[model samples]
Target chain A: EAGVAQSPRYKIIEKRQSVAFWCNPISGHATLYWYQQILGQGPKLLIQFQNNGVVDDSQLPKDRFSAERLKGVDSTLKIQPAKLEDSAVYLCASSPTGRGALAKNIQYFGAGTRLSVL
Target chain B: SQQGEEDPQALSIQEGENATMNCSYKTSINNLQWYRQNSGRGLVHLILIRSNEREKHSGRLRVTLDTSKKSSSLLITASRAADTASYFCATDAARGSNYKLTFGKGTLLTVNP
Candidate 1:
C-alpha cells in the first residue's frame, strides 16, 4: 500500500509571507493528522481530522495557521504571514478509523515538508 | 512538564553493540509506542506495547512497559550504522479516542560503523 504523501519537500519564504503544504493520505484511511517538528524536538500535533470533521486541533496556532480536509481525503495546511518560529518540518500522517485500538492508532507518516522562514 | 521524557538525550556506540534508551511519562496510558526518525525524514513506527503487555519484540527491537512506574525502555541489539537515528516514545492516554500520542523530546542514537 502507498504511504502518506506530502508535496514540496523543502520550502523557504520570508517572514510575513504565506506558504501552504499539501498532503495525500493512504487510500481508505479515514483519519488524517498534521504535525510540526522543530529541530531537536519530536513531532507536535497541529490538527487531527476524522474524515472531513476535525477531531482535535487544540495545539494549532489559530491566528496564523489553518487546515482543511474538505473532501475528507486530501488535506492542506496553510500559514499566512509566517514567522521565523514557523521554520520546521511539517509531517502528515493517517490511519484507518473504527478499527481496534491497536490498529486505529497505528499512524503512517509522510516524509514531511521542511519549511524555512527568513 | 512534558508527558514523556526520554533519558540519556544522546547515545553513541559501536556497531554490533546494544543500544538502550529509556522514556518516562507522567500519566496513565492505554499504550506506548516507539518510533525512529532518520535525519531529514519522518518517523517510522517500531513497536507498541499495551498497558497489559509487559514486553514485545520485533526483529531487532524490544520494548518493555512498566505501568506501575509509568516508564518504558527500548533495546536495540547488535546495532548497525543504519540504526543511527532519533528514537522517540509516545504515550496514548487512557481517555478520549486514543488518537492523540504525547511524545517525548527523543533520544538521538549514533551507531558508528
Candidate 2:
C-alpha cells in the first residue's frame, strides 16, 4: 500500500501572508493527523481527525491555524497571516485504527512540507 | 506540553557498536513508541511497546520500559551508518475517549562507517 502523501515538499512565504498545505492519507486509514516540527525539535501534534470529524485540536492555534478533513480522506491545513515562528515542517500522518487504548496507533507519515516564513 | 524527554541530545559512534538512547516521560501512558526521522524526511515508526510490556525486541532493536521510573530506553545492536538519524520517543496518553502522542526533542545519532 502507498504511504500518506503531502503536497509541496517545500514552501516559502513572507510574514503576514497565508499558506495552505494538503494531505492525502493512505487508503482505508481511519485516522489522520497533522504535526509541526520546528528545527531541532520533535514534531508536535497540531490536529487530529477520526474520519471526517475532528478528534482533537486543542494544541492548534485557533487564531491563525485551521484544518479540515472533508469526506474523511483528504485533509488540508491552512495558516493565515503567518509569522516567523510558524516556520517549520508540517507533517501528515495516518493510522489504520481510531481512538482508544486498544486501537493500533502505529502512524505512517509523509515526507512533510517544509515552510519557510521569511 | 512535551511528555517525553530524550537523554543525551546528540551521540556519535562508529559502526558495529551498540547505541543506547534513553527517554523519560512525565505522565501515565498506555504505550510508548520510538520513531526515526532521517534528514529532511518524515518520521518512521520503529517500534511500540505497551505499558504492560517490559521489554520488546525487533531484529537488532531492543526496547525496555520501566513504568515505575517512567522511563524507557532503545538499544540498537551493531549499529550501521544507515541508522544515523534523529530518534524520538513518543508517549501515548489516552484522555477519555481520545488518544494522542506527545513527543520529545529527540536524540541525534551519528554513526560513522
Candidate 3:
C-alpha cells in the first residue's frame, strides 16, 4: 500500500510572503490531518478533516493559516504573510476511520514539506 | 498545547543494547501511540496502546501504559543502528464526538553500530 503523499518536499519563502502545502492521503482513508513540526518540537496539529468537512482546527491561526479538503480525498494548507516563526516542517497524515470514537487507529504520515522562511 | 512529554530529551547507546523511552501526559486519553521520525522525513507509526491495554508488543518493541500515573514507556529490545531516530508519543484525546492527537517533543535516540 502506498503511504500518504505530500507535494514540494521542501520550500523556501521570504517573510510576509505566502506558501501552500498539498497532501494526498492513503487510498480509502476517511480522515486527513495537517501538522506543523518546528525544529526540536513535536508535530502540532494544525487541522483535521473527516471526509469533506473539518473536524477540528482550533489550534490553527485563523488570521494567517487556512486549509481545505474539497473532495475529501486531498487537502491543502495555506499560510499567508508568513513569518519567521512559521518556518517548520508541515506534515500530512491520514487514518482509516471516520467520526465517532477513536479506538486503536494509527495514523500514516507523508514525507512532509519543510518550509524555510527567510 | 502539547499533551505528551517524553523523558531524556536525548539518548545514545550501542547496538544490541536496550533502549527505553518514557512519556507522560497531562489529561486523560483514549489511547497512546508512538511514532518514529527520521531526519528530514515524516513520522512513521510504530505502535499504539489503548487506555485499557496495559502492555503491548510488536517485534522488538514493547509498550507499557499506566493510566493511574498518566505515563507510558517504550522499550526497544536489542536495538539496531537503524533504530536511530526521533521518537514521539502521541495521546489520542476525545473531544465530544471528535478526536485529536497531541504529540510530544520527542526523544532523539542515537544507536552506534
Candidate 4:
C-alpha cells in the first residue's frame, strides 16, 4: 500500500528553459492526474489519464505543456520554454477508479515538485 | 477556472477551540471533498460528502453540505496545534467527464498551543 511517488522534490530553472517532472502512482490505481498549484491558489488540473488514455486535458497549455502516461502506471509532465508564470508547484495525484464511485474514493497526492523559474 | 471558493482566507485560533471553514461552488456537483495540506507538503484527504447526503462526521471532523445554496462547511471540534494547515474544498461536478475535482483557493488555519 505505498503512496504515490514523485521525483525531484524541488526544481529551479531559468525562464525559457525546459523542465520535466515524473510521477509514479499508487499500485492498482487506474487514474492519474497532474495539477499546477500556484502560490496562494488552489490546484488547477492540467491533465488526466485513465489506463494510458487521456481523459481530459482541456485546461492544459498545449503550446508549452505536455504530459504522457505511456504504460498507465507512471506519468511525466513537461514544460518547454518555461515562463515566470509557470513557477508553481506541480502536484501528481492518483485515484482508484475513473468514475469516483466509491464513497471514500479520494485522490492521493504525491509530495509535489516545486518549480522556481528565475 | 476555479469551481470553489473558500471564505475567510485566513484564521487564527487558540487550541481547544472550534474552527469552521466555508466553501461555495458555482455549479452543481456530484460530491464535495475537503483536504488538508501542511506547508511544503502534498494534500491529504479529510472528508467527502455526496450530493444526496446532508452531513457526515469522522471523529472530530464534521461536514455539512447544502445543495440548495451550493455551499459546504467543515468544522473541526476541539482544534489542536496539529490542525494548523491549509484546508481546501474540491468539487466533482455532476457532468461526469471522468469526475475531475476542481479545487478552491483554500483557508489557512493557524492554531496556537
The candidate scoring highest on TM-score is: 1
lDDT of 1 by residue, A62-113 (tens): 9999999998999999999899999999999998866776888888999999
Per-residue lDDT of model 3, residues A2-105, tens digit only: 99999999999999999999999998888899999999999999998999999888899999999999988999999998999999999999988644445316
TM-score of 4: 0.97
Using TM-score as the measure, what is the rank order of every candidate, best first? 1, 4, 2, 3
DockQ of 1: 0.74
lDDT of 3 at B66: 100
- Model 3, which residues run further than 4 Å from truth? A98-104, B94-97
Q: lDDT tens digits, residues B38-66, model 1?
A: 99888999999999999999999999999
Q: Pick out the ten consecutive residues of candidate 4 chain B with the lowest summed lDDT.
A: B91-100
Better of 2 and 3 by DockQ: 2
Task: Give residue A34's error in model 4 in angstroms.
Answer: 0.2
Colliding residue pairs in candidate 4: none
What are the chain A TM-scores of the candidates, in order? 0.98, 0.95, 0.94, 0.94
Once fitted onto the true fold, the runs of candidate 2 whose alpha carbons sit more than 4 angstroms away are A98-103
Predicted structure with the largest DockQ when compared to the true one: 2
The DockQ-based CAPRI class assigned to model 3 is: medium
Each prediction's TM-score versus the true structure: 0.98, 0.97, 0.96, 0.97
Q: What is the TM-score of chain B alone in each candidate?
A: 0.97, 0.97, 0.97, 0.98
